[model samples]
Target chain A: MPGWLLTVWAAVVAMVVVFTFLTIMVMFSVWMERKVAGFIQHRVGPMRAGGFHGWAQSIADSIKLLFKEDLILIGADRKLFQIAPALVMATATAMFVVLPFAPGWQVADADLGVFLILALASVTTIGVIMAGWGSYNKWSVYGAMREAAQVASYEIPLALSLIPPILHYGTFSLATATEAQAGWGGMQWYVFSSAAPVAWLSFPLFFIAALAENKRAPFDLPEAESELVAGFHTEYTGIRFSFFFLEEYAAMFVMGAVGAALWFGGWNFPGIHLLEPGSALLQVLALFAFVAKAMALVFVMMWVRWTVPRLRIDQVMTLGYKYLTPLSMAVVLIAAFWEFGLHLIQD
Target chain B: MALPTPPREPARRHHYLGDILSTIHSTAKGMALTMRYLWRKPVTMDYPKEKPVIDQRYRGIHVLDQQLCIYCDLCAKACPVDCIEMDAVRHGKEIEWKAFTLDYQKCMFCELCVYPCPKDCFIQGTEYSMVSEDRNDFVHDLLTWKGLREEEPS
Candidate 1:
């Protein structure tokens, strides 16, 4: 193959890989969510779908959704309604372009990886708003407005919370940030780093903001089934409904992947440093370690979701604006001083 | 049931720090409770596959030992809803049993008829499944066998 053709070929393969990973992970998350929710409520969820705790439950659900009628509202802005889910899904997938899965396995390790991810995530809100407005329903518009308000307020704190790690790593790239945490057999993760208090404060701030961004519980006003009637995706049915669902879990994994790279030492594990660098075995092990870390964070998201009840819209806004934003700003200030001191001493 | 919201705190005492801290405290407690339940056995019974251990005194459907019934009309008369009906043909010392039906739709499983039975042979059994598509199917015949059986006492 020619050099340019090889580049194009590699890009195609990467897309296929990421898309496959996203679908499988979303399916698995759905199954995990049901099982976890059931376990908490003292009932067995989906016991006989594919046997052995109903492993194929989500797969069966997706297949059912696929054959369902693709409902399009008569009063909807047809263009925007049709495009909304695709836009949301695209942004979520785009975030994976910067996520360094293994040591050198990322599709595109952009210099502005962290910044680009944060930017793209907020764009998902625009797609949501489009869905709401385009649906031509009062309830859908309310859901959209609520989502806009929540995401706008939460994004500030979410972005601010990343400053400590970004400052410590001295780069905007997530790969660099992750590599910096590889010291001390992966014990030097940001939250436990030299700037302990700042990183510690920032982590919870980041996590809460991330939860709000993802529309997770205690902050899940948008998708409040009891009150909202399925929220922004109310008019969506069939495969289109599944797209929004897919976007949600995909976004969760992106958040988890970003968190792992930024704070939890991406692919670095104890005894990992002993392995030969750049070796195929090392890369494979690193990929597993990285994915395991990310998935653990995703599991925590599910655990918190099941544990907490949905917050009212006002309360979610209050927490995002009043609590998280101020706290993250303070963390950022301390982080700046800590990094400055480290820079002078090391130089 | 009406849900109890958190008590509204006065503005003087309601600082963000304290409120957030209390939220965290309560959330941790709730999470720990759920986590404990996660490891505990699920309380759900797999119906159709695993039958429940019904008590000996459970009032389900009536079971009549026809040979011991003695053709008394007291049990049928004692039924509050008048759901029980029976007839027997006399053949010298032996009795030939006919239909002994109880309309379960009206019977109520109250065991009212059992107390009036002189022979103590009319009683409720623990087989409680009563599902049917036809209305007449609910009018259950309590007798396991009709007419005089070989096992019946002469």
Candidate 2:
């Protein structure tokens, strides 16, 4: 086969894999969210759907949502309303392509992997805004505007916090960044790296900013269900609503995966360096390790969502600009100086 | 003594470091408490799968002992909602059974009809989960042997 054909073939295969992973992850996250919420609240959530604590509850819900009557509001911009969910879901799928699942498991190893993910991630807010404008509803407009501002504001801290790892690894490719961190078993993971002790702050900063970016609770003013009645998707029904729902979990997984790859050493478990290289078992272990780390980060997001009450919109803004942005910038600066001082000592 | 005045104004307080510290402390405490509860059993029952511990004295659907019941109308008269109704025929010394229906739609399950039964035959059972699509299902017949000859004195 020709190189272009091979590239096209590879791209198609990669998309299928990523899309499947994203769907399964979303289903699992949805079920996990209910279970976590139920446990925290001292109640059982979804006991009957496919039994066993309703592990298949999300599957049942997806089936229900798929068959739900698709409602398009009168006076709505039909074109934009229909396309917004597709846009959101598309961006999420695009972002997942850049994430390094294992050594060769990524859909695309773009040199600007993190940058591409970040850029694509922000485009979802546009889709959200379009959804808001398209719906022509007051509550949806509020949700859309909130999402626009929140994503815009949180993007600063989110990108800022990532600089420490980017600086340490000195690479934009997430696969390269992950490979650079695989040393000393897992001790050399940037969080515990002596080269940049301040990078520890960056992970927490990134996690919190990512929460706001994903519109998880404490930063979930966009879809404040009690106040906004499902927010930008208020006018949406059926598959379109589920598309938006799927996008939320997909975004969360991508953010968590990025966090894992950068700060937590993606696919690099304890004593992994001792394992025989270029073996099938090694690849499987690497995949498991990366997923485990990503899931842990996702778990923390769910945990925090249940733990903290939703922040007021103004409070969300204040935390993003005042606390997180400044804090992340400080971490980045301090990390740079630490590297500089280490270089001088070596000379 | 002078009447104590309730403060009219909300207290204004701002201690950034202390506030931040306390916020962290309180959030950590709350998360810890919830974490403990996560492992602990849920207070709520599964409901359908697990039947609740119903009290012995609790009034539920009426369970009438047909063998002990006399055809006296005292129980029906004591009902506040007038839900209870009974009829029987006198055949010499023995009574032939007839309709004895209780309209649960009007029956309050107040134990009023149960208490006024002369033979101590009628009482409330703990079963509460009676469901039916038909409205007439609420109107339950207390007698199992409606116009029966088996319990008749020979």
lDDT of 2 by residue, A147-183 (tens): 9878767999999888888887889999998888888
- Clash pairs detected, candidate 2: none
Candidate 2 versus the native: TM-score?
A: 0.94
Q: Give the alpha carbon lDDT tens digit for every residue of B1-154 in model 1.
A: 9899989977776777899899889988988988888887899987787999999899988888876888888988988899999987878878778878999889888898999889999989999998999999998887767787668456
**Chain B, per-candidate TM-score:** 0.84, 0.86
Local accuracy of candidate 1 as per-residue lDDT tens digits, A161-251: 9888898888999888888888877678777778777777778888888888888787877767888898899999998889899999988
lDDT of candidate model 1 versus the reference: 0.87
Number of the predicted model whose TM-score against the real structure is largest: 2
Per-residue lDDT of model 2, residues B64-128, tens digit only: 87777778888889999999989998777566788889998998888988777778898898988
Candidate 2: where are CA atoms >4 Å away?
Answer: B1-18, B149-154
Distance from true location, Cα of A227 in model 1, Å:
1.6
Question: Candidate 1 chain A — worst ten consecutive residues by lDDT sum?
Answer: A191-200
Q: DockQ of candidates 1 onward, in order?
A: 0.64, 0.65
